[model samples]
Target: MEYSFGPLIDENSKILILGSLPGVRSLAEARYYAHPQNKFWKIIYGAWGKTPDADFDARYRFILGHGLALWDVVKCAEREGSADGSIRNETPNDIPALLAAHPNIRRIIFNGGFAFAKYKKYFGAPAIDYRKVLSTSPACAGRDREREEMWMEALGRSL
Candidate 1:
């Protein structure tokens, strides 16, 4: 059973970015989007016309400073590999409780189809603004312009 990391969030956070769960590399490193190929940090930094720092702690601070928070939909799950298709017997995170506790969270941006689907399955439609952006995983293939535009639209515009 693979477990997700604790949420990188605080009372100042306005946008909650949710993924399905961490992949092998991220789990190994105990960080979000730790896979070198993942485009999460790239897209986020691009939103502010900056570059991601080499250090994970710096990146975490950057996200927090931007009023963004990160977490996963699945608290724990049995899965044979990183592919979303392999996920099963999943236990969901207490998203509703989190939302209630953090009333400043005005939007939820699912990091991919899997995260969005899982959120719907567990919490139904949330009372706040929510949308699904393209996955930043390397599994999605080809770091293309469309991905940039989509992610920029979701996170680049405003907090």
Candidate 2:
């Protein structure tokens, strides 16, 4: 079974960005968006008019410092590869627990359709609205400007 990464959340977090699961490269490196072609860091940092730092430590700080958090909907699963379509026998994360623990989390932005669909399957719709951005995985083919705009719109602020 493939396992997903733990959350990058804390008490200061106000927005939670959820991915379906870490890609193979990210899992290997034990880092979010570790895949070189993934635009997660770029879009996030660009939202604040800052370039992503090469140092993950700085990236982590930047995420939290901006009241952002990250996690995945699937905790573990059997999957042929990084593709969400390949996922099966999945186990979901305790998102309710996380939300309960961090009441400061006021928004959830799914990384793609998979994350949102899985979240609804496991957690149902909540009081907080649903928001989604295009997948940042290189495997997804879409306009980069559209993807970047989606994140900026979903984030809704410098917060």
lDDT of 2 by residue, 1-159 (tens): 999888999899999999998989899999999998999999899888999999998999999999999999999999987899999999999999999999998889999989999999999885675587898888777678888888889987535
Which 10 residues in a row give candidate 2 its minimum summed lDDT? 124-133
Among these predictions, the greatest lDDT belongs to 1
Clashes of 2: 0
> What is the per-residue lDDT of model 1 for residues 34-67, given as tens digits with 9 covering 90 to 100?
9999999999998999999999999999999999
TM-score for candidate 2: 0.96
Candidate 2 ranges beyond 4 A from true positions:
none
Q: Note the Cα lDDT for every prediction shown.
A: 0.91, 0.90
lDDT, model 1, position 18: 96
Distance (Å) between predicted and true CA of 32, model 2? 0.6
Over 4 Å off, model 1: none
Error of 1 at 34 (Å): 0.2
